[model samples]
Target: MSSLPDGVRSRTVSTDRLETHLLETGRADGDPVVFVHGNASSSRFYAELLADLPDRYRAIAPDLRGYGHSERRPIDATRGLRDFAEDIRALVAEIEIEQPALVGWSTGGGVVMRYAIEQPESVASLALLNPVSPHGYGGTRRDGTPCQPDYAGTGAGMANDDFIERLEAGDRRADSDASPRNVMRSFYLAPETELDPELEDAYVDALLNTETGDDYYPGDATASENWPGVAPGEGGTNNALSPKYLDLTGIVDIDPAVPILWIRGAEDRIISDTSFFDAGYLGKIGELPEWPGEDEYPPQPMVSQTRAVFEEYADAGGEYDELVVEGAGHSPHIEQHDEVLSALTAHLDDATTRIGNS
Candidate 1:
């Protein structure tokens, strides 16, 4: 387990839905703020953020089922991210937290979006960091349209086998590109960011905590006649993120809008217009063979899709602010901590004020 900062405390909260581990700090009676982590990560990623939050705010980071010290519950991909969202609902309720400002990173962003959509009344505000598209991870066009009916070239099949092997073996060496440490350095943050050795080891430990199997991390996949030749299966994290089951655009229809803060690293490769993880992007870059022309299979315009949806969200009476941290990558909150924290705190304060006035 990674060492917790001085003010932060760790504990497990059991609810009917799932047993979740949480890292929490700040005053117990203060306004609540919850942090949701991305896939293959745990609450440990937010240890610093939780510790640094203003003393007037209660900051809590939960380990979603199957990640960190949380229970290894089977995810039902067919329900999209609802399982994860519901677990969060249970946790908040069990802890007596009401209408918290929800901060979600990557897949956790998708999960919270689903939660806000299902129960917008429960969310005071929403903060998304490098989130997956509202249309889900891949196999979708700019307008949230599926390129292939079967939604191929996504889900568990997209996960790297070598990386999975290394992760399963708990390989901590930064020797290979497939190693968790290397992946975090190469893809999780900007190339120029100098990572502290101890912090690197802590992050690697969090990465290795991911539960691996067909029912977990990458999930399962099946044959497809589409270009990439693989479609989403019925279980696991990746499949739940697949456009086949996840669509959060209904956020535009929430009657009473939840204020949203969208933050991302300007140099993010994982969730960008040309994401390194997307097969369509890879095919365009000539990394994958048998290039199907752009018209047939173009790279997903992920950032564009998000912008369009946010615009629609605005037009529908919701408000949002987008911040792009220059020298950061997927984890802007970590790469440029002070800057991101400044904006996040202001947002949370504003949201809390609005809640109080209402």
Candidate 2:
């Protein structure tokens, strides 16, 4: 593993399911806060954030299975976010963390949602940072309905071949459009914002740790009737995030609902209503050719779907707060650090109070 930023220490925790690699900071006996990272990223992404956490909080960021230095466990995509959630559950149990607050970013948000749904009593609070939709990533309508029963235009096939190749080869070239480094700069943060060389290098290193293959990064694919002509296959990272496998809309039914804090970047291109990563949107703009009209296959309303689910959760007695970081992109934590820190600290404080009362 590369050298972590100041105050962040690298460690491995052996859970019943898998041996997990993590970066941790703050006091070991302090309030537990677990940070879950998203796709193509690792715990290293939270190194600075964890290191800067309040002294009273024990912040830990684990590299989910097959990412970073963790064990390369085969992911069962058909299980949706269960594999990741179960690993988190086991890790928390093994570490004896009691009602830890979960902070999930992007895909990690989906995992934490699943964790909360499956084990609500174990969660103190939830902080979703530009999370994927409760209905999953793609192939869904604004009302959270699937564009097709098979969930085409999503999963592994949606991944760009050149991008995956660059990732697999650990390409660090900034010139190539497919390079992970370029992708991070273009989509992870505001395009005009310059990244510190050290931070940029570290971020690229973390991305390079992603395991790429039919059973990992992009996963597998199937034939499709959708414009993309590809559907979600049975297994892998992308498949795991497909709507066919992941759906947390049932969260409204959880008894004793967990408090939630939804933080998003106002300029996030990856999770927006017209996300550039979404095939339907790409097709609509003629980037993918042969778009099957908006009515038949509209772009997945990522943010709207999240709002609807959270609205339902609120109606069911769950409380939540949404904060939009203006001018930020997919990674508001990095782009708007001070704002994110303040929001997270406040949310954690509330979570502590809630847990105390409960």
Candidate 3:
């Protein structure tokens, strides 16, 4: 466990799969709420959120395998997000948590969605904060069909080399735009939002803890005929998230659908309809070269795809709601803390009531 803020304590829980590191708040006897963090970030990212939760609920945020202080386990990208979902399952079992509300942010949201799909009976509720598309992050259309059979335009090939180098070196100097610190400042919040220097530094430290290699962060790549010239190479986090491997749109088929709360920053650029990071969008905007034109290589309709899936889920008798925080970016919980907290608290309460009634 690493040093964390007051009220947020760290501990290790041994699961059948691995020894997981977690940051926890609230009371041991309280209802459980598991928080799953996104890519490149550790459980520490949720420290403030955990501490702010009502005392009746125990807030626990665990560092996913291969990230933060967790064991550096081999990630089988072909399993899609199953590795992460199973890890969460094992953690919940080890902790003896029952019917815990699952909260996921960014890629973490994808993990929770898979969890709900695989173990619908175990989940009490779900909250997705700027989650990746249900069809996966990239290499797909609005309907989740791969643009190419090889799933190009995604995976490790899409990651910026300079950014990876800066992250690996723990580059704190904001001199270069590719520096992790600068990237976080630019993309994690709205431009006008003022960040506390110390908190920002802590968040950057969490990002630096990410393991970078062909087996971890960005994964590996292979040659392709697509405009990007590369495709997912079978393993690592990014590859696991490629449309070739990940897809949760079938969550609408979950026998007993879990209640869901979809909250996101309206101005989020990372997981938006035209994500700034998506190669197709970058190419269309002349930030990248040789886009195959919109018909052949359109920018991924991330938000639209997610909305469509949730719409189907709702039509299938699942309860779902949406909240868009104005002027926020990828991280609404941090940028618009009070509003997110209030909404989450209310959602959790409603979920608890619903579960109790059932």
Candidate 4:
């Protein structure tokens, strides 16, 4: 494993739902800030961020179930990200973390949003970094409507088989388009952006730690009569992110509304309207055969959906800020470290002041 970032410590904590491994930094008495990593990643991704947080803030990043050093527990996709959210709840309780500021990246964004919804009083603030849509990842419209009744063309079936194979095999070499390293470089960051070699290796190492099977990474897929001939099955992480199961639009209605910071890379291909990872978008671009017309299967307007929902939240008396970082991709936190940190810390500070004043 790559060496941990300075001042970061790794430990495992037992929760009611699963055993969670986490990276932590800062003083025990400092204000709590929890960082949740995206899918196909682990807490290790946040080691440097945790190490660099302001001294007055205690930062914690946990490996969700089926990732990192955490227990390999089967995800219950039927509940969407609730299982993941509940795990965070359990961890917060176990660690006695008080009114934590929550930061979630990619799929982890869905996790924290769900957490805030289910446990509205728990979160002090939320930061979403290149997150999935408020409606879910794919198979949805700008108004949060499902394109197909069965939610076909979403979930584990959307995953590239070759990439899954390489991930399961732990192929760290960037020799193929499907290799985890190459995929990360291509889709996870700004095109041609080169990470520090050690951080690159550490990120890949975290990616490799993802548990793969019908019960994990790509999850399970069912045969479909729809364009993709596959639909989400009721198991695994990917399925949990499927719109058929996950609907985080209710976050707008959470009481004691938590302030939000939504950050996205301007060049992010994963969560954009024409997301490269979305099958519907692929069909529109003629990347998939037997193309379904745009009306029947349009590219999900993910960013628009998130914006619409946040607008509703704001109208309902909540507050949020959206940051679009240029020359970056899906993982802006890694690609534009200084800029992201500055925005994040300022947001946290504002939240801290709000809490103190209240």
Which candidate ranks first by lDDT, i.e. highest? 1
lDDT of 4: 0.91
Judge candidate 2 at residue 43 and give its lDDT: 91
Per residue, candidate 1 scores C-alpha lDDT tens digits across 1-358 of: 8887789999998899888999999999999999999999999998988888999999999999999999999999999999999999999999999999999999999999999999999899999999999989987888888888899998998899999999899999989988999999999999998778898889899989999888899999999988888899999999999999999999888867999999999999999999999988999999888758788778988889988999999999999999999999999999999999999999999999998999
Worst 10 residues of 2 by lDDT: 220-229
Clash tally, candidates in order: 0, 0, 0, 0
On residues 21-77, what C-alpha lDDT tens digit does candidate 2 reach at each position? 988888989999999999999998888888788989999899999999999988899
Query: Comparing candidate 2 with candidate 3, which one achieves the higher lDDT?
Result: 2
What ranges in model 3 sit over 4 Å off?
Answer: 1-3
Error of 4 at 4 (Å): 0.9
Residue 4 error, candidate 3, Å? 2.9
Off by over 4 Å in 1: none
If scored against the real structure, what TM-score would every candidate get? 0.99, 0.98, 0.98, 0.99
User: What's the lDDT of the predicted structure labeled candidate 3?
Assistant: 0.89
Error of 2 at 226 (Å): 3.5
Candidate 2 has an lDDT of 0.90
lDDT of 1 at 95: 95
Across 115-162, the per-residue lDDT of candidate 4 in tens digits comes to: 899888978999999888989888887787888889999999989899
Model 4 compared with the native: what TM-score?
0.99
Ranking by lDDT: 1, 4, 2, 3
lDDT of 1 at 3: 85
Candidate 3 per-residue lDDT over residues 1-358, each given as its tens digit? 3456678888889999988999899889888899999998988888888888888998889999899999998788889989999999999988889989999999999999999999888888999999999998886777889877788888988998999999889887889888999888888878877888888888888898998888888898999987789999877999999988898887898877888999999888899888998877887899988888888888899999999999999999997899999978999999999999999999999988888789
Q: Look at candidate 4 and tell me the lDDT of residue 344.
A: 95
